[model samples]
Target: MVNLINQLSMPLVEVALVLQKHITALMTTLQEHLDAAQQSANANVVKPWPLDVEAAESSTNFPVEKVMKVVDSQRMDILETLIRVTLIEIDASIIEGLLALRSWEHLVRTQLALAKGPGQLFSPLDIPEDW
Candidate 1:
């Protein structure tokens, strides 16, 4: 959004920071527009609004389906944009995302265990009827 991409200089760190800023802004915009889907994702990415939260999941509101539609529409644009970038930059971003996901998984597990007690602890992978 800031147009900080100095192509002449080609500073990887500066470019990456610009990209990260844009991504964060985009995510913030999406979350504002698709709050229900965002909330469901934050609660459980795998099962997504699998709990009693389905009461609000209607066609009128932001559904995961709608989110997918929005994303799918831009899929090609995303690919096209990424295609211009160096492979190392894309790989670095992806690896960073994966690392963040791993850390998030651990944090979620720890939070769940603390909330439910040791005996009631369950892995997020386990598809239990109740969370």
Candidate 2:
């Protein structure tokens, strides 16, 4: 029984370990992208205009549209990363739930077997036919 439990649990542990590694990789990638985007934006800052009347006015005026566009684009990228991470987390939860269910099923079956004594046996057919 212990061996059976161990065998069933080993795969679940492996899957969790793999998922952790994947999440770590994704977080690292997200950080790198964010850093690169920030550096790119900073490096691409518009230069000040010449001292002519129109140029001076334009330089002094706030570029609301350009700033908004940069903000929106960066927000979208961050949202995308968040959505991906959320999906990974949901998948991990599902896998963990399945493992828990399997463990519970094994425990119930073991209890039944012990209660029914050594020579006696239990089978799936013992369950209700409708089930």
Instruction: Give me the candidate number with maximum lDDT.
Output: 2
* Candidate 1 TM-score versus the reference: 0.25
lDDT for each residue of candidate 1 in 12-110, tens digit (9 for 90 to 100): 222332344444544454456567565522433222122222222223333445433433324334433543354336564433433333333343343
Pairs in steric clash, model 2 = none
Worst 10 residues of 2 by lDDT: 43-52
Q: What's the count of clashing pairs in each model shown?
A: 0, 0
Compared with the true structure, model 2 gives a TM-score of 0.23
Candidate 2 residue-wise lDDT, 1-131, digit = tens: 22332333322222222334444554455447667887422211111112222211122333445434433334334434443455566674433433333333333344333433321221221322242
For candidate 2, what is the lDDT? 0.35
TM-score of each: 0.25, 0.23
Error of 2 at 116 (Å): 26
Name the weakest run of 10 consecutive residues (lDDT summed) in model 1.
1-10
lDDT of each: 0.34, 0.35
